[model samples]
Target: MTLPWETLTGEPRTVELYLTTPAGLALSRSMFNSAVWKPAIRATGIPDDRHNGMHVLRHTYASVLLDAGESIKALSAYLGHADPGFTLRTYTHLLPASEDRTRRAIDKALSEDQAGDDVPPSLDGLDTA
Candidate 1:
């Protein structure tokens, strides 16, 4: 993805592989450190002394996906986690609600089946004296 832009040198040029605004410009470490991170942290209302950063966004993304029933293996791959076990260990706290939902789904299915079993089989075109 190349876009026309002016470099800091004031030379007109095109940049590639950039996603953030000022479209063609890629994020520089200095830009992140000085411009982006502090403002985002302030906006989030997290104390500056506490832990908060892009990693928090990553964890939140994983947690939301897990709560929505996305597979752990898939999430691990998405997160670039080397092993599914690490992903599971990291996010195990998010799984219990999913397990409860699974249990409820299974119980509903079994109850529906039991209700069906209570119905007599249809007798069509039969004669009774």
Candidate 2:
């Protein structure tokens, strides 16, 4: 579909807008690179390379959300992945270590039976003396 555009030399042109702004406005490729993306990448102090493009941002997006404890099913839908299993496979390394999950699970289960600051009840079969 043809979209409106302006040339660097002030000529009006017809073109397709590729990247869009967060506010939903269509941005031509040049406009997006000059006005938005280039500045953001420069701010990060990393030299711009052909390999460091929008897909890098997408990967970082997934990494940050996974680190924040977002569920695979929810992240999958947010990322428009067809299957949650794919999301898990792609981002499993970003999840917290199993030890963290185990600790949280024990803490949560015990806290529900007490005021959270109380000492956990000792398992009857374990002797700690």
Candidate 1: pairs in clash: none
- TM-score, cand. 2 vs. native: 0.52
For residues 10-121, write the lDDT of model 2, one tens digit per residue.
Answer: 6466655466777657766667777878788889986877567666677788988888888889999989898999989988878866788889988876565675546566
Give per-residue CA lDDT, model 1, range 7-94, as digits (tens): 4456466445544546546777557745788787888887665367555677889989987889999999998888999999999987
Q: Worst ten-residue run, lDDT, model 1?
A: 120-129
lDDT (C-alpha) at residue 22 in model 1:
63
Cα deviation of 108, candidate 2, in Å: 4.2
What's model 1's TM-score? Answer: 0.60
Per-candidate Cα lDDT values, in order, are 0.72, 0.74
TM-score winner among the candidates?
A: 1
